[model samples]
Target chain A: MSKGWDPGLVLSWTVAVIVAGAFCWLLGDVFWNGLGRVNWQFLTEAPRDAGRSGGIGPIIVSTMLILLVCMAASLPLGVGAAIYLSEFTDSEVGFGRMIRRSLEVLSGVPSIVFGLFGSAFFCIYLGLGFSILAGGLTLACMVLPILIRATEEGFRSVPSEYRLGGAALGMSRTRRLLYLSFPAALPSVVVGFVLGLGRAIAETAALIFTSGYVDRMPSSLFDSGRALSIHIFDTSMNVSGGEAQAYGTAVVLVFTLLSINLAASWITDRWLYRESIGS
Target chain B: MFQFSSDTILFGVLRLCAIAAGSVLLLVFVFLVVESWPALSNVGLVRFFSDESWHPAGENGLFNLLPMLWGTLFVTAGSVLIATPLGIFSAIFCHYYAPSWMARVYRRLIELLAGIPSVVYGLWGLVVLVPLIRELQPPGPSLLAGIVILTLMILPTIALMADAAISNVPKQYLHSAAALGLSRWSTIIGVVVPAARSGLFAGVILGTGRAIGETMAILMVCGNVVQTPSSLFDPIRTLTANIALEMAYALNDHRSALFFSGLLLLLLIIVLASLAETVRVRGEVNV
Candidate 1:
């Protein structure tokens, strides 16, 4: 007998379509409202009146600077921690589990709390003031767990035979990890970086207190700078005339994040395809 | 000998990084508690949690968190209610109904959605969702706007988690259901979903954490009013929002009160996260 109309299928399809439609609507609305406002000037010129007039040049520079600092700080810490977990420690037992659990807990801490912590430690305790350095460090802390987790997954995916092969060659543990394991996990680690980049770009609250929301081009890491995300919040919340610029910044932010995520997936997909073929 | 020493140094560095990463969480707790103690001691812990008003600047300097706490709970609960069913169904569709290519695209799109910054979502809520709400009801920013934005934000988390849970259901269970002449829909409902219940529950819990912790998005659309919301249309402030909004200017008791609010949020998140972890562990054990 021909299957009558399946309500479950209908319901599931409806749900999927609704969610997908909402996503499309959101992206479309941002683009529709934001695309026209973006231009070369907007990308290069500094804000004139509290980001209410002129282009978001300084904001772009500030965002990139903060991201650069964040990546520089977090990459070593996160990847090293991941390597330690995967290679040196018995990750299934005591201290390793505690580390993993702590990462989990830290990841779940709200951005606002991180804002407070960032202000307390980096801005005040470290005497960085409301500077790019403090903001970047805060973001680094925020991203460390994600990076460690992703990089650890990469390290885990390396075949054990590589370890054995290295050992048979009388390679030291460091030699094995540096040349064999790390290279193999480099793609995954890159993926982690891209993910962290996306996060660092999107972060607002963590940077708001630490970064001090200055609309000027930063001369050094010590200088305060406004990020696109924080710019969006500031314009919409405090400023009266920066609404259009906020949309433009949002579009730029969304596009940047989307591109990073796409690059990440492409990298992971290529790696996985190669992995499967090699296997 | 040089190589060995270098290797030792490298390993030590890695171990140090790992230890530092682990200690960050403890440091966060310590800093928050230390900062929050001024308010805790000044107002006394009993009044902080028990009071209804959140006027840190008033003559009495009330730190009653019930209003903001209730606001957070109300918005979070509302978001959970909307997101859970939709996300679960979306997950089911992704796993079962969609073709392989469609599933792949959907997964990528969901990830993209997840990657979009919370601030963008807030901007969208302010420009689109808030006005939409205002058209239907005066005063654009309200609990409803917050809930809707939060529901959208958390969908990827719940959907992905549920999709994983659904995918992990044993193939044998489906095969057995098929052998019993149960339809695909019935089998999923009667067997597959039931088997994946704990995993789904854990997913929902994780989604709850995400929703509750969400600040900027809800902050933008939720009107940021300090009073407890009498209805979904009423504007409200969350604990996160309260701190974000007031931390810049707050001093003494007000500042400590914000820190104390942070402490309370930390506690709430810790509870939710541990519960999610417990459920996930239990699910793993069951499997």
Candidate 2:
């Protein structure tokens, strides 16, 4: 009985292996095709000849600037919402539930719809036009749900004993949150921030309209700038001989995402380790 | 007095931010309605459903979104069909068969897949999947290509959620099944799967939402032709693709019509999200 062949086990293993193999194939193909085109120059020079002959320097700058604006706008709002939901309001009640539901629906709202909204509300109504500011604000709306959810989980993990201790010491609620809960939840908040950053950086559809198609170096927040993801899309679809550059940009984007995710997991693991030791 | 005032100000600021965050969804809906009002009034809602094609420009322009709507649903349905079984099985393997370390690594891998940008997936689809499909058929970019790419894109969502669902199954049920001399497969199929049914359904619904909303990847591989796909190999365009492709140059009624398409997408997503939320809430209560 111990040695008999098990079809279920065999099938499951096969399915898992197939999925893993597909992932490896996809990542490997991108690297194999794109690595040759990436270098120091590619990282630091502006693209030329419609992105067929040069690097993605300006695109990288634009992506970073847009990410900066997105983070600056979303971090406070997301964290505040999380604090409001987790600390101030009862989760089982009306306003909290409504906020959570709205977030759920917003998270599920298609990025393309956000693109439309961003173009209408930010680019047109607000007169921001196709600029980094508009793109960042659009991403802020999109990233808010993810950030709030993760940060809320982090805040919820804080022991109530800590809060009680703060109260016993006559610490004000705001002071307790700042010195006790906020510090304790820093690891999760960082993880959430990194996740939101990754999403904001990888965004293409939401940024395409708001960020515009300009690939030059953006001098200010008001200037239109092409994002790395958009660059990848434009090169792959619009330009005829831009496959190499597209792959290069993709490699950069994937590596950025990989590093960010790895850093997040590392922080989570370290926090868990510290907890185990302290307890 | 200073401390109290400072605390009040901080709380006030945070409350304002939360309110702002919550109102964004409503604002998005209202703006889309306002922008699309012209199209809704001039073209009328009936034309949107009844017209023949999506010719939004020139004289006698047709504003029908049926083709794109069908394309979105058709592609989403196809991807869901392929991803659901594979994702469930993958989750099952990770939960029951794999060693703990392997399971951890595999779950991380899936998360990494989720983190990868949609544009990268789109690039890969265009360069790799499209060409592979082309060998099987004449034109490369087709509904099949879109489905395949979308299946890959949404697989991680389903797999991760299913994995969580499977993990949440109480250990007592497994113990009881084993005590009754049931086989592992039978325990999984009869007890664990049934126990996690609603959660898994929620996961599928969420994945469906993601697939429907996906734009760049599907846009790259679906050939972007505004036609009702006759077969899986035929070129098609999704509502998302239609909006992204045309928003650059569309004017007047054309632009308004795109906004209308977005409104439709928003409404569809809201329904899906609410359904998922309800299922999840019920599952939590039942568990």
Candidate 3:
């Protein structure tokens, strides 16, 4: 019987760590060189060098706008689907399980497929064109599966005692769900939103077709807009010498992802810890 | 019903949004049909599936997924070959050898790795991976590059899933094997892996789904060529990368065929994901 650590394991692990280390090195390079490019004008100016006159003001605003629109579209629907499956369905027959599995499949679907569907549906069918509304609506579909699964898992984690006790007191199903179940799962649902937000903010391919990749800031939902992800994509693809801007964009995007994930983890831990105490 | 009241109106809107979930799939099917219809009717479905040429802007000839399909499959198989052994081994090591404090930290690292966006991975690949590939080969963006990139990308998911599977191999089984005077190596290969294969298989399949559908990273690294790669060093395109690169510019039946590619993707995920569901049942719960 072998008792010691495998040298092969250590070697393979070191190789992976070194590769990951290279990634961090690139990040450092970006900060060292790319920081100077990310100033007040850089933030406020519309992509001038690429668009020929500029700041990232429009892209940031557009990204936030898309997030709001996407959440508005996906949240209620996903939560409802989660609730209908978790609370309403008879899991013994596998109906809830089937739907749950489908939701996971949906989560794993590449966003590009969602983008293709969006471009065809919202951009042409709905006459929304390459507008912010079209982009957000497309992403709404993309996030729905994740939201539903997370919400369901959150609701499932709530002990049946709470619901059984409510029922024993003759409370209605709807009443118990709204008053008790929703609050208990509120933390998890928030985690889902955070995940969805990070996804939406980083999304590029989906927005490319539906949102139509405009560089300028928009004042209305009907107007086309670009997000930070699209800005990075545009810089990477279209700009001839905007590697500086691309690195700057990557730093912003990476930081946004890391911070949001951290915040969600903190919220999740804090809520679970609080929930465990006598309540 | 107090239709004009704020609460009633709010409920009405929320209900509409909620109902739209059912419409979500319908919306996808209908939209793909609408966009792809012109192309479909023009070129009968047979030529579309049978042919392999990929000139979207060219005249009269638009059919065949052989190249892109081949490409996607190539990279996927390559990634599977790379990730499976490394990931399974890492999972086993973490489960058996890691100290408790280190296990939690390592697990978190895996989670963080999974959370990084595809585009960021593409960025890192472009800056680092491409150059490394180019140095060894004639030019960059070979299938090798894509494979290595994908292996790294899927490691965290595969590792975490494998660890869950390994952990599910009951402690008593290990102790009993030890009691029987069996070696640690024998216990793992004989007792642990065989017992938890379903979970490990599920994790591998999940990684496959990820590798097959990966778009952005392949778009950046896989040399956008429609050719059968003879070696790992050859630049090739994947079905996903093809769709991403060509979808925006495609017209007519080319468009329909692209949606068909999506349908194909849906079908692929459906199969593996169904298997993954069974695997999920076998593996212990993980967040």
iRMS of each prediction: 1.3, 1.3, 4.4
What is the C-alpha lDDT profile of model 3 across A80-149, one tens digit per residue?
7777766666644665555555566777777778888888788877799989999999998988887876
Q: Which stretches of candidate 3 lie over 4 Å from their true place?
A: A1-36, A51-54, A92-95, B1-19, B181-183, B278-287
Q: Rate the local accuracy (lDDT) of all candidates.
A: 0.89, 0.92, 0.76
lDDT of 1 at A10: 91
* Tens digits of lDDT, candidate 2, B104-211: 899999999999999998999999999999999969999999998899999999999899899889999999999998888888899999999998998899999999
The order of the candidates by lDDT, greatest first, is 2, 1, 3
Instruction: Kindly report, for each predicted structure in the order presented, the TM-score of its chain A compared with the true chain A.
Output: 0.96, 0.97, 0.92
lDDT of 1 by residue, B1-287 (tens): 98889888998999999999999999999999998888788899899777766778855887788888888999899899889999889888888789989988988888888888999899889988999999999898999999999999998988888889898899999889989998878887899888999878987888888888888898899999888888889999999998888989888888888888888888888998899878877878888
- Candidate 3 displacement at residue A22 in angstroms: 5.7
In terms of lDDT, the best-performing candidate is 2
RMSD of 3: 3.8
Which runs in model 1 stand beyond 4 Å of their true positions?
A1-3, B1-4
B217 Cα displacement, candidate 1 (Å): 1.0
Docking class of 3: acceptable
